[model samples]
Target: MTNYLQLSNITKTYGHFTALDDVSLSVDKGEFVTFLGPSGSGKTTTLMIIAGFEKASGGKVEVGGRSISELAPHERNIGIVFQNYALFPHKTAVENVYFPLQMRGVSRVQGLRQAEDMLSLVGLKGFGHRHPKELSGGQQQRVALARALVFEPSLLLLDEPLGALDKNLREQMQIEIKRIQRSLGVTTIFVTHDQSEAMSMSDRIVVFEKGRIEQVAAPLDIYHRPQTSFVAAFIGESNLIPAIITSGAGKTAENPTLGAFQYAGDDALADGQKVTLLIRPEHIKLSRSPVEGRKNARMIVETIVNYGDNALVIGRAGDIPMRVRVLGADVVIIKEGEECCISWAPDAVFVITK
Candidate 1:
């Protein structure tokens, strides 16, 4: 795919501190790419640079094969939605949506009609007359979205726009936003610390850490084949065991405390190289006895966290902490403070060389 948006060797620094270090990425037109990382991980700083809110200390920002490096925020023709919605409280929903078009020289009669259509598209058809205070959180979010899309901006930037909504509303908006983006076929860059949101909404996820790009891949690829230990740990619950590669060709490694493990993939790993092995919790099975034809280990159950549909069985395999995810029905077979056998397949083990 052609790069609709490109950041070429972008870097940001404040005094002696570096906020972004040589970050580069290419985003396809009409694709939804999420910038995901923890707080202070440079994800937001990168987004700010792309939106022209934060000037990069180095590199270039390009859109549609042209340099937008020097464009001011408004001149960039980018629509931004903030965590707080940033809606005009005194203005009604339609008025809020109309403001952007008005700034673009659209007439009151035409802009208001276009704003109503946008609001209706966002599922707030009859609520356009209501002020921000009169509308629900989700409604206000719809208005924000409508306003952003009203002018047909070149790109859409959402900086944790769902952060202020409740869980249910946030989930609802995720679906709504994806639908709208797809319908409009607009290029989008979403910034959020929420991994589940990234996984659910993004076509690709770009992981940021310490002002550098860690891994940029599809959601499942990032989860199952993490390029680094940090990606494995940060994206999901994992049992990361530090081990020495015993046989690179055989795909085996040995942890000092937890013993030897057989993995599925071959890497550029030398024999006796120290590495970390990642096994997702959901890939492990717990039972009274070892399952046939599987890698088994003994774990003393430490804690059981039940979440109705599924439960997390936390325990220790020797000195290594292990977590097993079991179905709610299967969790009945085990309890807290009990000794159990945990087993996983060789393919379940992912080796993170970094």
Candidate 2:
């Protein structure tokens, strides 16, 4: 697939502080790509550089195989939607949405008609007359989205677009934004600190850390088979246990205390080499009785937390804490301070370096 937008060796530095470090990535035509990371991780800075708000100190920005590194922000023909909406309080929704078209010398009547259609597409039909303060947070965001799309730019950039809404509203807007992007078939780059939001909305997620790209993959691939310890820990809840490779049979590792489990691959790992095993909470199982003919580890139940649909059981194997996720409706509930064994398939344990 051809990429619609590409950032090649892009770097941004503010004196001694580097906001983005030699970041290189490409967004396929009509594909939704999200830059995900914690605060100060360079996700937003990368988006700003792509939008031409921040100039790259190195490398080039390309769109449709054309170099856009020297293009001005408006000349880049990129539509940007910000968290604050950035609407004119006194202007009505229609006027706000038409602002971009007006700047391009579009007639008032044609601009208003186009803005009206954009609002209707975003489910804001008949809301064009409302002022910024007259609408809710979600409605204002919809207006901002309409404004961004009215120009029909080659790329759409969203910077924490749902960060201003409540949790429920944010989720709803995520679906709305995804549907709109799919229907419009516009190449989009979304920036957010919320992992769940990015996973739910993007065709692919690019995980960033400390001004560098950590890993970029589909949501499921990144969640289930993380390439780095940071990617594993940042994307979801995981139980990391320190262990050493004692054996490699059936492509598995033998933990001195956790027993033997299948390894991901037949890599040449030296015996007694230290490694960290990553296991998602849901991958673990707890039982009171040991099953015969099975190699597994035993742990003492330390705590149990019931959260509506599921229960989080915290257990201790030796001195390490392990968490198990189980159905809330299960008949067997392990009490705190009780003894239980936690076992998992070898394939479920992901080995990572420190």
lDDT of 1 by residue, 1-354 (tens): 677999999999999999999999999999999999989999999999999999999999999998998999999999999989989988999999999899989999999999999998999999888999998898888899999999998999999999999999999999999999999999999999999999999999999999999999999999999999999999989999999999988888998776887898856678989888999999999989989999899999999999999999999999999999999889988878889999999999988888
- Over 114-149, each residue of candidate 2 has an lDDT whose tens digit, in order, gives 999999999999999999999999999999999999
- Candidate 1, superposed: residue stretches over 4 Å from native: none
The best candidate in terms of lDDT: 1
| lDDT measured at residue 213 in model 2 versus the true structure, 0 to 100 | 98
Clashing pairs in 1: none
Residue-level lDDT for 341 in candidate 1: 93
TM-score of 2: 0.95
Backbone clash pairs for candidate 2 read 251-263, 252-263
